[model samples]
Target: MHVTLIYFTIFFLDFVTHAVKEDSGYWRSKARMEIRRSLSYEWNTNEAKNVIIFVGDGMGPNTITASRIFRSGETSSLAWEDFPHVGLLKTYNTNKQVPDSASTATALFGGIKTNYEVVGVNANVPLRDCEASLNTDNHVESIFSWAQAAGKATGFVTTTRVTHATPAPLYAHSADRKWECESRMPPNATRCKDIARQLIENEPGRNIKVIMGGGRQTLKSNVEATESDPLDAWACSRQDGRDLVDTWKRDKSARKVKFAVAENNEQLRKVDTDQAEYLLGIFANSHISMDWKRDQGPKGQPSLEDMTVKALKILEKSANGYLLVVEGGLIDFAHHRGQAAQALRETVRLSDAVNATLQIIRTEDTLLIVTSDHSHSLAFNGYSDRGTSILGIAQRSKHDNTAYTTLSYSTGGPNNYAYEITNNKAVRVDPSRFDTNEFTYSQQAAIITDEAYHGGCDVAIFAIGPYAHLFHSVHEQNYVAEVVAFASSIGEYGNKENSASIFAVDCILSFGLFLTMLM
Candidate 1:
């Protein structure tokens, strides 16, 4: 009853707001679009020529439910939630029960469960042990290598730095997830390579046709203030005096590989993806701004939707097909800071990116999978009224006459250095005074610790395309790569080299066997 009342109230409010601002045609058009979306659903069983994976870094079931309820009382579903195949992915790493991005990434992209904090390596290697990583047996191939080997274009897009844990596993094999640049690497580990360097120097990593995200500080010898959002600047500037971006450009030039770097909205608009086979766009120095707040700053950042469309513009040029991975990685970053509003906005941005990408591709021929690297510590509690602002305090706790937020994290960043949110004796606030819906709002966190840890829940994987039905059962996270590999006929699953001829002979033998039985 409470939920129904809340929905009706929100719907009425929205109607009034739209009545004042938008024309009647807007309402008619929106209804038509919604109907079209429902009618467009189809069982795509055709062999996938292209594969696109969208990773919502910390989106667990709780995150999805919270997002849905927050938007309105259960009336809306995320764009990808309607996908034909939804599976629960077991995310425990090879060593740890609650895995981090690097380990989970190796499982999803490398098709193997690796040790915690290690990226693109098998379980044979230990974390941060530089020497152990040098063994050839420790190295593991990723989706990028398999795609490239099969003569397909490959790329990845992320809200985090391009060399961050999630995207790094696509091409980089690092002993330490912290080894993003030379400055992060130890002098003793000379043989071990950092992520940014490997991204430029390694095989399939260097050969990536579309690389878009932040990490300008890691790529440059000196960090310059860009008069935009200060968050775009990184604290750990490269001290080695080697400009990796310049080196990358020189290498591409020497090899005659066409590439362009689109660093901002203006550049992104100007980059002619058709003229260039390779593109690298780094918009920020560290991680990019949160999606909703991105436009508020003077610094121009392209929306995830814009970046996805641009990537497809280039990757679509490949006649053999392409493999692209998109990461809404900042959702995890915000959750660690105990920022619920930011996380929800990032998740919404990812959904919008998926919806936009769907507009440009044929669903039957494109295998699209949406999943998360791991779950966050964000929790929803209290007997909050349904439709209570997701970030608002549920009416004061009758027990102590103190109010608590409907949304909160279990732990926080160093005794809540960034923001304080304690459970037992939390500072109460009047929800009426504060705008909980603000994008910059950081929700309350229950515990006071150093960085909220990942939750040990099975994140969801939503799929649409050929063999998507294979994801019907609950399975280990590594099965993700195996299913995609088999569907696309790449890597070890590349039995298609003579599969057509074998099928024809089997059919002929079936017919000939009938005559032999009669004889």
Candidate 2:
């Protein structure tokens, strides 16, 4: 027995030694490289001509760390991890400690913290109060409106419905986030327009150069399931019977602007971005499927990276620059279902989209901000080996000798009750007996509930390009919109006279420093 134990120990040590590249010189060289880059860094203070904000709906610090490990290895970094500026955002809304997407999105896009379930409106309007929402004084403008007012183009892309909570605040003002269509609204709320209608009839929405993502059923009238409407056969139709898609096309036609619509991947690829001034692409009836599932489904939908590249191609034609919002919306959905693997994969896809954008845009003129609307309850646990798989088991519990995964949630999930009552004591089911890396597998949770909840922790922010240095410290969530507005010289902070005055002062200070250096 002693000889066998000694042989197994030797094998384990040898495996670990080979798995990790732990040469002291390797780490020292990497540290020196990072130091050299930092010492030679120069701040970009140029005025931003274009802005792109990439939001991972439920991606928190923990999720980012796990994704970095899953995508490459323990020491690997995501695309945005190399950004020069990093900060933390306080994501609480006025009404809740642990906020939802709607309120947080409103803060990020509208520059104000509002109540939960509210969008594009101030805190003065109560949630679900249709009369309160109709008051123009209670409404707040977003970055999209600012961009349009400044003669800059604007657009958005998401993995979920275009009118979903995370993207709705950019163009829609509603008392309730659920009011995506008239059918979803209460009968008494006749004065309030549905989110889809706002996107078609409102100022910034109607003028938006590009719109993509799901929610076809909300935009069209009642129709039977056909080859075209395969995904949303059971989805609820618009109660107003007005085809918003047709409305959008007619409005654009009246203005005599070049416009195009695409319902599938092939149609989208066929669009002439150079000629089309307006574009709309809706590939799913509701939220788009998870990345892996979408790949296995019909070949109609485009990946998030594909949509992002197309949007940039169209938006880049604007001579005055553009403001675009891209969302990895499915990360939140996957976390709610307790699918840690799916959530991490979605985060990686968001990173892929960011990398693609970096390839297409010039960082000298464009400001790119990558952040999260909120965080999930997903927790990273366990003391695994040097190069253990992120989805594999960590260590066994000493109390019961049951294996637990590296990723688990704080509360709620299908795996919350994954135990057996034996002899009046519960024993956690051994995860080693099955494949925990399956896409459908749910990580264990601390408590049993219908769904996992959002975490109250602050999320991370990464910035590059012009004015990136503004995000060097912790800040409120609304600071994000403020930075975008200030950098692009748009919104209330963007008057020609004020900008000139600030520029003059900067020049005076710069000249004084130059003279002192000469002395």
Candidate 3:
């Protein structure tokens, strides 16, 4: 409700400015610059102190557009609509036109394009097999790594496996990005150590204060040690027999790391943030369910919003501030399913998470950025009103009649099911209503696409907090690095000192006053 009111207030202010400009030709000339300046003042700039980045995995432009219509009652402007800055990011790999999770995440966190399957390393050479692992040693330092080195508390939270692509590369370095655990993706026993083991047992103690998400099954064994999984032998030393969780407990450096294994939301909510320094909450055995199925979340599962809020509470305690990365990991799952309804629903969930984050952000010191690594092919089509349903064909009218679908599927129907575009813009409830139990929600509305597979669509990014103005162009993926580096006062090469330039410093102070009138 607060977010909605805030958005409406901003809209009204923008409307008044537009009206004034229309009445005065002279005022129109300065409108663009004035708009930029007004936006520049929307946050407190005097004491820019922290940085938080929220990445909606696989959420592109089409995803945000679709989500807006569902979440806002009617589509007008999104919460991020007031951001004066915008920018494009490149997601292509050094070897392929399309990139995978490992390389895409590596580029975002590591700041260099790597091979399709590599993590935390640059792809300098070509012609490597798809499965060939890239060495992660000596790569660009991750933002989390930098934060830890600078004496700031650093943490990772996600709906995906904690060691998954997006969060793993931040602290773990390995030749094979796919190796999730010492037991599953074991290191070459003759050549190297296990990345998963290093992630828990080998890193400098107390660096990662909080680690949350799923993949616990991969970290533990049903019984204890055996010759079959020698890693289990080490696990047997602990009562729990979970290598990752147990190892952290045994390490003196991590004794201060507050650990919690929340299999459900109830436990998550009860977690005492004050006492927790290093937290590990794996809410699911695998990846947590998407929002559509979130209602069916496990007995104690925590909503993504709950986890994010808890994470912020813990990170905010640091004197030097902290770096926290929260991932809406289910958006990618929705896209992979080619279920637009679920995709949009989850995007709305992501928006709710964003709203919650903004609630606790007190100063302009924090830079809050929301973006996707790449895009999918899905998009908004046809001329329709704000609340028009995106699930079916959109029809145009000629005097008194409706038009037919300009786009639709070619195959897969009972009697070659043909749909018509209509002014009946009622929201669709089910996309697969008629299909058998083999699939669910057939009647639910969804975007019609050429393939049953996901496409490359443009991703949407919204920002309002500190240094967000830096992201205002259609540039490459590495642009995010520049924005974060500037916001956190970290240098590009990881050795430079933190400083807020004139614009950055001013924006910080002005944003507070601007929100009073504008928000």
Q: Which candidate is the best by TM-score?
A: 2
For each of the candidates, give the backbone clash count.
0, 0, 49
Candidates 1 and 3 compared: the better one by TM-score is 1
Error of 1 at 391 (Å): 1.9
Question: How many residue pairs in model 3 have overlapping backbones?
Answer: 49
Clashing pairs in 1: none
Summarize candidate 2's per-residue lDDT along 1-519 as a digit string, tens digits. 232343344345444644668799756865775676566557888889999999999999999999999987776678888787899999999999999999999999999999999989999989999999999999989999999999999999999988889999999999999888888788889899999999999988999999999888788877445543354433346756788999999999999999999878888889999999999998877878789777433356888899999999999999999999999999998999899889999999999999899889887889999999999999888798868889899999888788999988887666655677889988787888878889888888888788899999999999989998899888999999989999999986579688678769989999999999999
**Model 1 lDDT per residue over 1-519, tens place:** 232343344455455643465579766865775466546555556778999999999898878878866655554667677676788999999889999999999999989999999988888888888998888788889988999999999999998889888998899888988888877677888888878889998888789999998888888867775556453433355768888888889889999988898888888888888798999999888887778668623248888888899999999999999999999998888888777887887888888898788778877788989999899888888778765677777667776565667777777765333232568654544444567677666665556677777998899999877778778878899999988888898887667756566668879999899889999
- Candidate 2's C-alpha runs over 4 A off are 1-21, 223-236, 296-298, 499-519
Error of 1 at 435 (Å): 3.7
Full candidate order by lDDT, most accurate first: 2, 1, 3
Q: Point out the higher-scoring one by TM-score: 1 or 2.
A: 2
Which parts of model 1 are misplaced by more than 4 Å?
A: 1-43, 226-236, 296-299, 414-434, 497-519
Off by over 4 Å in 3: 1-8, 11-48, 73-78, 125-138, 182-195, 204-206, 222-242, 252-259, 295-298, 383-386, 393-458, 491-519
Query: Model 2 Cα RMSD, Å?
Result: 8.8
Candidate 3 C-alpha RMSD relative to the actual structure: 10.5
Model 3 TM-score is 0.73
